[model samples]
Target: MEENTDINLSSGKVESPSGRDDGDKFNLQRKIFVGNISYRVKQHQLTKHFSQFGTVDYCYVVKDHLKKWSRGIAFVTFQDKKSMTRALQATDEELMLDGRLMRVAPAEESKRVSYSEGANWQTRLPPSLPTQTQDGDTCESDFHCSEQVTLPNVSHLELDACGECAIQRLYDDSLMLIFSFLSVKEHVRVERVCRRWRHLAQKSWNRQHKLQFRHMFKGFIKGLTDSILNSLLQRCGVYLRALDLSASPQLLSDLCADSIGANCPNLTELNVSGASVTDVSLRTIAQACPKLRGFIQERSFYVGDKGLTSLFQGCQSLEHVDVQNNAGIVGDCFHSLPTTVKYLNLDHCTKLSDLGLRKICLRCKHLTELYISHCKSVTDQSLINITQNLKRLKVLHMEGSYSQITSSGLKKIGQLIFLKELSLSQNSAVDDGVLVQCAVGCSNLTNFDISGCYKHVTDLGIQALTRCSDLSYLNISYLSHVSDSCVEALATSGKLQSLVARTCSGITDRGTSAEPEHLDTSRSSVTINMYNLSMPHLKADREIMLRPADSSSEEEEEKEEEGGGQSEPVSLCHQSVMAAGAEITSDNEWDVNELDGFECDDYLIGDDPLEEERWSLS
Candidate 1:
């Protein structure tokens, strides 16, 4: 009897420990790569050829659009990993089909071998196949040459047996997926091909309606020139709903702006946040994209009141506006800002004062979210204005070192019962009384981050804010005054999905033990980070389960004499996704220090250039 060489094939119930089921075996998919195939071969032919070693589930030959043959490469998927392995082993027999020695491998491994070591990675036959029936001295070439593809179990294949290439018969969606890998230059060149390619090419262009040219940044000095911008706009701008040229600042000249205003009339969101864009471009953009709901010009230092006034006057439907770092524009344009504007961000406008903010609060009374960070000139008058005018505000971020804002201002803030997200970090105004007031009124608050209030607030304030039934995200990082009681309250609260208590010195063994012990399993997950100092006795509260007498007290004493390792309670209860104990660290999936707790890429890609994945012809 022959010894079985298969790993997990007998019942096909046992899984391969090598993780062969994942798509990494073939990055394009979980398929086997077939190489050195003959040009005349078809999908049915390859399927039949490979069906001997496994149940050939799928087969595809890669080639050009109109080409009648493959690029000498193909892919096949088997019913099981054992079948794939066996098929790979069978390739050692030369696997000659129509006289070409075919090579088979996992697609990812093949990529590494083919690219790094070149084509020598392909294995050759042992010069002859041993058999009792064949003559001992006869070589494979001398005995017989493979002149035709012979599929043993497959007698005839009427479906897809002809030499027509698979690439030419791809559906419209598949063709668009292929064209999506092409660059702007390639898209332009692709249209100059046959009309079928052009139709599919236009569909591919129309697929992504947002025209973000940030990926096309060629160099630090160069950008998408006016001509190229106009060309792309002429092709895709009719369907384009948003245009983002924030990263490609070199394309912000008057001519580029003119082309954008002329071409992208239906655009609703525009981000031209570079220092080089002028008032002329801003005014032109205002005259054009009137349906613009969101406009971001964060660092445009040259833009002044005239351009902003023009923009606000024209874009009456604007809902979200970010003019954070533009110091050139003052409050003279405040009246022009639309009443429909619901979200406004003015983070670092050094020239903006309480007067400007009051004008905005009076005009855009329906504002839902507002951010005014690091603007030193803003005082209690702005907060008062916000409470009186913007009664519908749900999010308010006044997170900068502002001594001008007093407790009275925060008391007025409590009047806005609709507030859900509030940040008063680094401001000295927050105290226990104000927190109690806000907690009583704003029970609907979900996200509260007051990390820098170390001087004034203590456990009294922290506990008061925790009373807000809806508060799930709390960041009391540097609150050195808060004690273990706060941690206990938070654990039993059952609503805190995320807790960031970084340097709260009062959290020791007591706090750590109380967290997991009092954890409310009603909530699906809870992440607690206590990263001041390492607590060595964290496992003191855990109930130990003793084993048999064979591993008795003497052995336990020996282990204890060495070191009975103790685990910190910082590991989130109920198997939360992330945990931090001695130090706050992330497993690259989430950021520990970022305010949102998720990596920037989790929301979007920040600062990193958008590198579009381009498909290489392999």
Candidate 2:
């Protein structure tokens, strides 16, 4: 058997190898010095591997001083002495690295002492360690190390106790606030952490008033059922104010409406446009949601006059009703419509006619905006009724309902001075007389559309509209008789912003080319689109030729002209227009030239071969 010996540096104590003093053993158990490590191993890799056994405070791989290459050795220090003890036990199992086994052991006292005396000893020592001089007094200088190397006084038990106290200091309300910032998915995920978090997450979800499950498309596997609605209502329906089930309305049934009516009593806005709801559901909503303000039941085919009557009778606070495209709705439904309603849209309700509109005008005096477009049954009598009553009307859309409306009705429509936007496109009977009446009466009109009125409208009608100086948007596309004179008149209005005159055969390049001069140059903003015009291609080519050229191209062209031999002579009018276009293209300067006749300078150039007979008149 080999003889064993033990040595202790602190207190100059010595003992047999088998009978080592506990105090000396504890003092030396601070750092584990590993040897025979792979040369390719880094400090962080060693630290990460050793951290699995215990909390490693610091790790260092020794390197060659000049070459900066790993020396196949490293040191790992731990915060507590118990962790060092566990790491020593764990090292008995071979640590494999790059198909090779590593060696680990407690550093020898001589090696530790040499390291303390090295030039980098000040940096290697832990920050929490206190240095002491030979006189037994703590010294502030980092160059010195204590005689005895010991672990920190903190243990695992003290760390656990401190963490628990920190958690206990937070109140329930503060904890809830911190949890509220997490997303709904995160809230559910963290519930598995402990019992307290699960309870708080459940409580927070219950208090949520606004619930939108539109993204959970799979959750509505079955149409919105009474059981599912009741389950949701039991949890959050009491406090719910806004519920959006707009997505997947096919899942909504009559029971879902009843569930909402019974549970969500404070509902203000309801949208069940494409649902399978019937007249029974509408009656239930009217009786249940007394405080309802806005209702949208577009395309709900089963809802007819009976449903409308029930809704109007129960929901007195209703302000907006949009029953668009509901063909079953007839004129008789407006008889029961609440007077409190201000905005009503009966668009595409083909069954509604003048009788229904008359009832609406007589009852709904607070109406400010009405859209009955595409209701072909509506005629001049409907518009006459609207103007007679709803004097507060600001927007009226009568598009596609021009079969029975003539200039006589349009003349009466001009009496509504509050009209700001008017659309009478596709009306064949609208002529210049109606426009004259509109200009004389409604001067505040901002947007006017008569795009498809191809019959009986000419420059006379456009000239009549010039009195409305505030017109910003004008659409007279497809009108065959509107010419450049109308465009010039519109440009001089000074406030025109957008003008759409597509397919108008009378508007030529010359007329549109001169139209810009009459615009409000002080504002410097004008947009004129002449799509599908007779000379669109020619106008595009002319616009390209009018683009300004650089100084090099200009000099080249001048030299070519100076050395001219058989080049064609350019017209004076065309040259002056090119110069004006170039100046405008280069500097954005507008030189508004009059449309008077131009002098061709034909006498100086000799007899011009390309000169037209019209030039002689100029």
TM-score of each: 0.56, 0.55
Residues 201-256 of candidate 1 have per-residue lDDT tens digits of: 87787755687765666787777667878888888887788888776765556677
lDDT of model 1, residue 604: 32
Q: What is the C-alpha lDDT profile of model 2 across 293-396, one tens digit per residue?
A: 88888877788898888888898998988889999988787788889998899988988878999999999988988988888787788878999999988888
The residue pairs that clash in candidate 1, if any, are: none
lDDT of 2 at 564: 87
Question: How accurate locally, in lDDT, is each candidate?
Answer: 0.68, 0.69
What is the lDDT, from 0 to 100, of the residue 359 in candidate 2? 99
Candidate 1 regions with alpha-carbon error over 4 angstroms: 1-186, 192-204, 214-223, 514-618
| Candidate 1 lDDT score at position 122 | 41
